[model samples]
Target: MTITGVDHTPEVLTVRWQDGAATRFHAIWLRDNAQGAAFRHPGNDQRLFDLTEMPDDIEIADAQIVAEGLEIRFAPDGAVSVFAAAYLREHAYDRAPATPDQPVWGAELGRRLTRHAYDAVRDNPSARKAWLDDVTTDGIALLTGVPAVEGKVCEVAELFGFVRETNYGRLFEVRSEAQPINLAYTPVGLNVHTDNPYRSPVPGLQLLHCLTNAAEGGDSVFVDGFRCAQKLRTEAPDAFALLSRHRAPFRYRNAETDLSNRTAYIETDETGRIAAIRYNNRSAAPLDLPFDVMGDFYAALRRFSRALHDPDGEMRLRLEPGDLVTFDNERVLHGRTGFSGGARHLQGCYADKDSLHSMAAVLSRKSA
Candidate 1:
């Protein structure tokens, strides 16, 4: 957008754009956002000065449209700042904020699940970017034709970010065990739930790669926790409010390790937008709410659990050897059916979402 004209007061500056839109910029905001080398670090774009150093009564002395963008002169200090036209439009605060691009889905997603071949993602930047984008938008993705070997899950994680090693080590095994330390090592059917809710900072992403799968009935299942939360928000507002308002405790303990955390079942940001979902029935600790609220809490919890187990909310798939799945650990609940007879084996690992997002952004810039 090109700036056509400028009108200003001591405190605010209004710019008229070529598209016939007018945007008002606060003098303090513009002063703080100066992108010049003297004001910000060129390498990282971090601000050079502290906010406390800025004059409290700063005002705009004058403003004008320049060839590069919009230029403003500040009073007192007489410092000149220029901003690109595109930058101003991109950061305009006068308009309503854009809705998040994330798309929530349920069992219907099974019909057209986001999928990418392992070899293609390894060799093609565009293919990897698309797959990462899929995981970001839908909270899950699948990869076929993986090597079906040990520790391959780590390699997939490296494509985006380093593995987040926990007490389970760099990569954990998944299969029936003689004396299972965790319920996940058993052959019994598991309920749809998030992983490691007991940790302070739960794993942001999870990768499960199948090395072998000859068991009779070990199909994998996924549920969109975001979808479940939204259903409660729309159908049971009181339940949703309670779940988001109160904290639930979760814990995991063994001989050498004991981890515990307390968080809202349905987490929300300052603007009340859903931020994350932490639900793990097996790991939840005893209730500690007030006596009066205990009954209501349990009722709300049951309603939320029902939403999670709704048949229409589940997507089921049977993984074959060489197949791998990646999902947002906080947003997608995973489980499996009981199996017996033949052997079934898989490898899993954890990683953070920030690194995945960083990789996607760099790839996008390179492609552009």
Candidate 2:
């Protein structure tokens, strides 16, 4: 990239990068992010300068486009610094932030989703990369030929990230049982909802590998919470606003521990893209908005809840033995239909979102 021209204002330094794209950098930001021996330690890339001591009106005494980069001297200290054009271009904050490239989907996704063989994930690097892409874009993927052994789910998580161990342990068993500590252990139809809404920064991904599914009715169900939120925003703006604007309390308590958190049912990032969703009716504590908005909030909640239960917004799968289903815990609401007769067992675990992204970036770099 070539710097065609450079312009300086009292508070900003604007650079015209070639091809008509102009980028501006704040004077203070440039000073703080300078890449000189005096300002930055080369070994650790740590800053030696006390940025808090920087003046309110720091000015550029001089600036020139050098062959290597843009060389500049500040007014007060007269400190000379050179910023590589490539570095500046790469680090510019003027560009819009990158959002997750997730494609919202509903029931139709079930019919078209790709199924990879579990053996390939372990034996082939490219198959593991494809698994990464599936989780990134569609928020879900299936492995048809997983080994039907306990703890095999851990291998799938290791390809992307470490397994997240909670009170449920590193890997939890999903099966019907009496005196169930969690409803997931009972043979009942669970409401469509995201997991652990009571916890801040809930688990990012969930993997459920069926060891046995001899049941008559219990089938895996998934609903894209993001897709449902979009529908609610378009159809019921007021309700969507109510859910997004207010923080609803979610709580979970057992014999030994009590956990709670307050969060919006729908969360959005700076660019108004759906970031994370937490909608566990079983874990929802109570409606605690002001009395004036409480009724409206409840009404809005009902509307959103109905949309999630709508068949059109849900995808179903009958995961047989050796089938592993992985899904984004924040974007997808997962549940199961009640089962009767015969046995069904699944081994499940969680992984963080950042770790998955980190592995994907590394893989992309290697492949590129």
Residue 152 displacement in candidate 1 (angstroms) = 1.0
Query: Over the full model, what C-alpha lDDT does candidate 2 score relative to the true structure?
Result: 0.88
Q: What is the TM-score of each candidate against the true structure?
A: 0.96, 0.89
lDDT of 2 by residue, 1-368 (tens): 99999988756888898889888898788888888898888887799978777776688877789998999888786778999999899999987788753469989998899999888877777888898889888888999888899998988898888999887889999998778989999999998889888876788999999999888999889999998888898899989888888999999999986889999999888877788788999998978789999889999999999999999988999999999998999999999899989999999999898898988887887888
Q: Clashing residue pairs in candidate 1, if any?
A: none
Q: How far off is model 2, as Cα RMSD? A: 2.8
- Local accuracy of candidate 1 as per-residue lDDT tens digits, 186-259: 99999999999999899999999999999999999999999999889989899999999999899999999999
TM-score between candidate 2 and the true structure: 0.89
Provide the lowest-lDDT 10-residue window in model 1. 94-103
The count of residue-pair clashes in candidate 1 stands at: 0
Error of 2 at 31 (Å): 2.2
